[model samples]
Target: MKKGLRGLYYSRNEMDEMVAPLKFALVGKFSSGTPSIARIRARFAFWSSKDFSPSAESLVVPVWVSLLNLPVAFFHRKSIHNIACLLGSPLKIDEPTTDYTRPSFARVCVEVNHLDPLVNDIWLGDDDGDITQKVMYKNLPLYCPTCSHYGHVERNCLLKAPKNKNTPDVDSTSQEDLRIILDKKKSKLVEQPS
Candidate 1:
């Protein structure tokens, strides 16, 4: 009983929101695509992801890039050289910067954005039929400091906070986000940079 692509996508998106920071898994047509060492060495960056990990526990989801598998790129040595020349240099990615200017499987870097949820969804779908109900999680909102917003936290808060940004919001409803908002675990979760 393979869950359709859309169904799988929704389910995985739900799960990823739970485990922020690490353990992002990809499930799709090429979920097991060859590891492009070149891209790995290029040092790609991942932008902010809304739901990209597992919940209540540390996760290890694969950051897989959807590839076209260009035979010419690998078969023709000249093609590789020529493309490299046009590429200019390997792109450097950061929190806000992703390797998109001229991304290459040869570059060793791939971008993981929460915006593209279908691919990860498909990948997860192929793994198991009954996985849907087991991994679903709710969307986590960012917290605000000025008006006490719901989606952003203090460190990156767009507002001014009288207290440290990491301070738990007393208003978080039933502990289901991340720690204070609505964490699925309904328990205190330790925050660490992943």
Candidate 2:
């Protein structure tokens, strides 16, 4: 499940301010696993506000905590907590809490599995968070390796020029390579004598 667009002109620190006490998964996390109530429990964890940096509209949970609760966190398909306890994994039955007092917001994350065969698992929702927004139905686009972008699904990228290359960034790129690209385009036009 995707939320609405989160980042337009938010800086690292600014993002923190808006989504303070909110946690999110970094781009490189692996939350795609089989959809089991138990495994879903493991993905859920507490996210500290200090380390709450996350991708646009994507929530981030702590790896350590999410990993621990894998077995009995999610109750989507079935909530057989008693059965789980019989096997040894204990279940936590508490009200969802995302208090501002604590630095970390604890959540139970489940592997976002896709019902359709084509699309990847969009994050549906977490057991310990409020993801009941209307916009969540319009899932956020999947991550892309080629353009290094999110928001739009990779297959949907149709722009001629790469968008990220044009964004003003913190690190200054050397002009040598950029100049070469500009020159290459110029020479291609000259070939037509235009």
| Residue-level error in angstroms, candidate 1, position 51 | 34
Score each candidate by Cα lDDT.
0.33, 0.34
> Lowest-lDDT window of 10 residues in candidate 1?
92-101
Best by lDDT: 2
* lDDT of each residue in 82-162, candidate 2, tens digit only: 222222233342223222222222232222322222221122233333222111112324644445455555567655345
What digit string (tens of lDDT, one per residue) describes model 1 on residues 10-36? 244433433332244232232356769
Superposition error at 25 for model 2 (Å): 41
CA lDDT, candidate 2, residue 40: 67
Q: What is the lDDT of residue 9 in candidate 2?
A: 26
* TM of each candidate vs. truth: 0.17, 0.21
